[model samples]
Target: MKRLILGIFSIICMVTANSVQAQDKGPEFSKLDVSPMDLAIYRNDKDQPVVRVIYSRPQKRDREVFGKLVPYGKVWRTGANEATEITFYQDMKIADETVKAGTYTLYTIPEEKEWTVILNKKTNTWGAYEYSEKEDIVRIKVPVRKAPNNIEALSMAFEKANNGADLLIGWDDRYVKVPFKTAK
Candidate 1:
């Protein structure tokens, strides 16, 4: 009787220890200098709060500028390595409408006429190569503009303002412009 009880106890202890060991042996993360989304809020002249979305990545040259080799009127992953992603901590309006606070995938349609920026429900996709139309959350049409100097690389930035921000996308001597403002 005592021997049986001791055997069961030992088995339980060994199983618990093995489970812990397995968990500890899971994937290890290294120091990765990865780009992340930058979101912020500020006030406008009327003291109204505004929201902003900033997407940044390491700049690379010799790569194909979007809309040319990347093509126009198609979904773009919006980033180099990973599908572009954005997070909004607070409720904000884009293009004079309201959107909830959440994480979203960002896509773009590059065209000679104008560019379309899309906010999608799905998050964390590899690139536009695997983009699915069903995952799109919202689409906003933004205008395209030419840059003064040649960029030769793809980059995006959001400049905070009193009421909103300027969504500036630049690549290879061209640029696209967009503005996001909070709805009342």
Candidate 2:
């Protein structure tokens, strides 16, 4: 009986030790991304954000951006990991076109002179690989302009205007502005 008790105690100790070791291993860090995630929010006077954009910022990394990494006339996910998402809390006119209050996936087609910005109904998508034109809610063509300086990471900024705002998207010495007006 003493030997059996000792054997049981030994097994318990071994199991406890193994469990402690496993606990000390911590969380696994498997996935790593060079480009990090970012967000752009435009708030109203009430401190409520009317527009929010969630996306990943990809660095230039000494590579060509527009015509190479993001080819011209091809649909781009507009970000790194997942499809860029834009949430509008209120109905607004984007580029003189009406956009209802909802969440939509923002895709882009970069060209040398102009860029076609698309708001698609499909929200949960990995990349532009699964993008469908039939699901698009709005498609606006905005002219691209030369940036004053190089923008290493992709960025979007909202500039407040009179009863409206301008959404500026810039990267790699180029930028495009999409003007929007809140629906009355």
Per-model TM values vs. the true structure? 0.65, 0.85
Clashes of 1: 1
Measured by lDDT, the strongest candidate is 2
Minimal lDDT window, size 10, model 2: 26-35
- lDDT score for residue 115 of model 1: 82
lDDT of 2 at 40: 91
Measured with C-alpha atoms, the lDDT of residue 60 in candidate 2 is 95
- Which regions of candidate 2 fall more than 4 Å away from where they truly are? 1-23, 30-32
Give the alpha carbon lDDT tens digit for every residue of 7-54 in model 1: 999999999999999989978877754544433444456655444344
- Quote the positional error of residue 175 for candidate 2 in Å: 0.7
Name every residue pair that clashes in candidate 1: 44-162
Clashing pairs in 2: none
